[model samples]
Target chain A: MARKSKHSRPDEAFEPYEEHAGVPMPVNWVAIALTIWGTAMLYDTGESVQESLQDRAEDSDVVAQSVPDEGTLLFGANCATCHQPDGRGLRDAVPPLAGSEIVAAGPDIVSRILLRGIDGPLTVVGQDFDGHMPSFDSALNDAEIAELASYVTTRWADTTEATAQTSEEVASLRAEIGDRGSFGGGAELAMMISSLPDQPPMPARSHVQAGDQAARDLVFAGRDQVWSCASCHGDLGQGDESTPRLAGLPGAYIVKQLQNFREGTRENESMQLVVQGLSDPEMTALGAYYTDLRVPSTARPVLSGDLKRGEQLALQGDWSIGVPACFTCHGPSGFGVAPNFPGLSAQHAPYLAAQLANWVGGQRHNDALGLMAQISEALSTQDRRAVADYLASLPPVPAGGASMARMETQDDQ
Target chain B: MNRYLPLSILALAILAFATLMLVIAPGMQINSRPAPEGLTPYSEAEQRGRETYVSLGCLYCHSQQPRSGDQAPDGERGWGRASVAADYTYDQPHQLGTMRTGPDLLNVGARLPSEGWHLTHLYQPRAIFDWSIMPAYPYLFDEKPQAGPGDVVVALPAEYAPQDGVVVATQQALDLTAYLQSLDRTYEVPADGLRDHGYGTPDGPEPTPSEEER
Candidate 1:
């Protein structure tokens, strides 16, 4: 110490045991990391640190358990098929649910229809329909029907008339109706709901039957029943507005329809009157005459519709609703399939739409196994119009001429 | 190079495992299933028609398999119920076609029961429908001055018929019609294997519930 050598300074003795570098404490770094992790958790998850654990636990127990729109789900499942989601009904076939008087009248009528299923000859909004609505009592429970009814009422019924249905009310109505067949047509239904319009009586069943006359008159000649086929149908059997063209139709098909009219199985007010005086032989003669009569299509499309949709229904059928293309059974171009399926090409649009409506209403049920009735039910009013217009636009016969061109082709072959 | 034997053994084991899992197990399961009720064996004529259908590429456009309601509206479309594996017991090589360019033929017989309609349709599809894009099978028919005894004459439209002769269905055409008419799978099957797929296709526009509905 006395020498104070050149190698060592006096300040070295005063220095502490260890040098103090300007580093922060380890605890400070850990605190900063913890703050960042907590911030990230709160920002990304939209969950606070206090409630995140609780939310996860509750989520596991009731995952996707919200039942907010129960009525919507039920309506879509049960009534949406025929009545349509918007409840407009399938025009003159099924009745409209939107702004429907029956729906507006309140839950009593709605509940009864749901439980018992109303059959037609039911008049809704001045339009007559004869559909066969299958009872939903067996298919849906009281609660489900209530939900469906409420949904329909709320969505389509007039706002002033909207009434919510309860399961209790539906249950009581179900008990009151008990087990019964469909409300006997619309008359019986009108009795329960006075607000509903009356369904007009079906054209009285003609007492007239085919007489025992051996009349061999041609189809063009006036008979006792009709003045002449040419009066309503053209001279060449080319039909007018809303009248189906009889020209070039299959003999078997015409005969079958004539027979159907005579038997009163197929309901046609005019045809019934006409067939009453005709014998089986006379019917056969008319079939032959019409089958032989080949005329170009002069019947223009009267009903307005989407031609594209009509073409699709005629050519590619809307499979979405289970309707096969018109060509599938009616033949390639709407020409009649012999003995059963009729030719739709060049047919009157109004007539086609009316027939489709008839099928939907169950007024015309003469189709094989109710095929038309089933298919027509699936088509909307717009779809029916579209198909009708499309068929009316097509040639009744193949392009070029008729048998002459076919014969020429055969000769060439 | 020395590990060649081990490598080959490993590859053989893997191949055997795949075969056992994929082919053998499924084949055994399918073989054990019983045929559904009313599933009768194909008749001689129907079998021949089946052969004709296979040869004619009818499967290219028409499907024999009508899927469940949930998958498609085959039932509502009047194609009958969904097909089951047991439904194919009579089929030598099953015709569960994938394409639906045409309607399903599984229940065509039920929908159209007339033999005459089928014959006419086969002879000339356009004779019944003027706008049908389906190719005509005029070759399947023979034009004769008059139908002979036991000959089935096709009832065609006046324009499509030969001016001097009636069109008679050939044996092949008859067989094909018979086959089409025989495709009736409308009988009920056991509910065990039948699944409910719901109506309409998956791609169909789903109705979204609005806020008011909620």
Candidate 2:
């Protein structure tokens, strides 16, 4: 054995073994290769781990693979700009789709909105967006309309549990409304559409039996409780001075208001306290019950007023003051848009006057209403009264009364 | 010789790494400095108030940045102008919060000119807003004890009640208020013709058609 000297040079020592080890083998080379390979493997493993963790965190289990495609195309073409692609809508102008009562309301109301258009004062997501939405009657076919309605109901509005509209239903509505111009406003449409022979009675609260019973029980048990839901809101769910009437409101609107109260966003002390104690289920039931209640046409009786003066102010605003015609947005009647605008007809005069005053006084500060305020401020005191009185005296438009052409023209502008 | 060779290589490697880091890493951002008008160096009292605002977690319920659409008439309602990134350049950690339990406070300082009104409103919101559901911040204020028989106390106006002689406004609140009041952006940029037109700045000729057209 040629024993290697202890102090032999590294090159000399390894030279003899190079052939056996294969490739100019040195002790450090093996170590370096192993280290590099190990690092590469570790990096690959890290990337895989990160990918897996991300996938897990995303919890793709809950998300639907693809949102329903039925109404998606139509909604995108017509509704998405204001309502948003996801149906969440801008904070105020358009109501949310995830849980709106209007979406949950029977197909008639939904179809009527599509046939006519909505306008005037309305609140969505606790903020008010008072803008006009054009009707889609001329733009979409009956099948397309039905598909879009179904999509909005099921996918965006989360009323998947609610009955989907059939193409036949859409056809019938189109036929019935043929050549008849758009309905006047939401109120007019609601009244007319509800009276239709094909229209179903308001969705029974019984459908949500568990929720309705629980809410009824809570409300009934707390009947004598001061400031209970029924105290300011009448037993029939009609609203009083301290509160807006809840009956006959689209279910989606009711739920949004309740959520606003609970979250302290609505900013009414009494409502906050009243809603603070309610569980989510209780709120849902209360909303459903109120939405199902019949809206008695007890809108305050039209008071005798200077009708001619009021009509003039409403139709032709005093442009010198920069006041736009009320009819430009509020509609011939004051029914407003279904989901966006509020019904002004038959509303208490005091409330209407107070709101107009609030707008001018800067107490009410909505972006959409801001211009209206400026316009209101320009009006003489008598002008304000005439408009308000005229608004209050007008009857709510019958359902499906708005014209597709009117809606289209409004939307284009 | 061997030791010397290894040491030299290691030193060179370390120097090269250091140089690389210095060249590649981001440098401190100094441009777009916030205007310091109306802002005072932090005082101990103001600092305490700031700490109080933080502890109360007011940011969770309010946003300082107003949306672009909000700039129209909404700004006149006291929400203020849309916030620019430069507005928060000085913040160590920006508090661009989300939530609107109350109105945005970006321009609240200018909106509420009356200090007394703020004090009274904070003590009891319903006193100011009959329908307000906002929680009262009585803890931020000192309640006057019922006047003792011999104590000669001057009745303050219904609105004016200082939290303490040294009013312990949360330093967070004071700083936040200071920050809010500092949001006056009334300087309208002049159109092209109005730009450097012999008013003072040196760089431009007298009014020309192109400048006037602008």
How well is each residue in B120-186 modelled by candidate 2, as lDDT tens digits?
3555566546767777775654344454443322213234344443223332334444444343332
C-alpha root-mean-square deviation, candidate 2:
24.2
RMSD of each: 19.2, 24.2
Q: State in Å the error of residue B28, model 2.
A: 93
Give the alpha carbon lDDT tens digit for every residue of A211-244 in model 1: 1223224444554224355645656677644456
Model 2, span A1-75: residue lDDT tens: 245766645565465543345555676799899999999999999999999988865655334344445467567
DockQ of 2: 0.03
TM-score of each candidate structure, all chains considered together: 0.41, 0.30
Residue range with the least summed lDDT across 10 consecutive positions in model 1 chain A: A205-214
In model 1 chain B, where is the ten-residue run with the lowest total lDDT?
Answer: B203-212
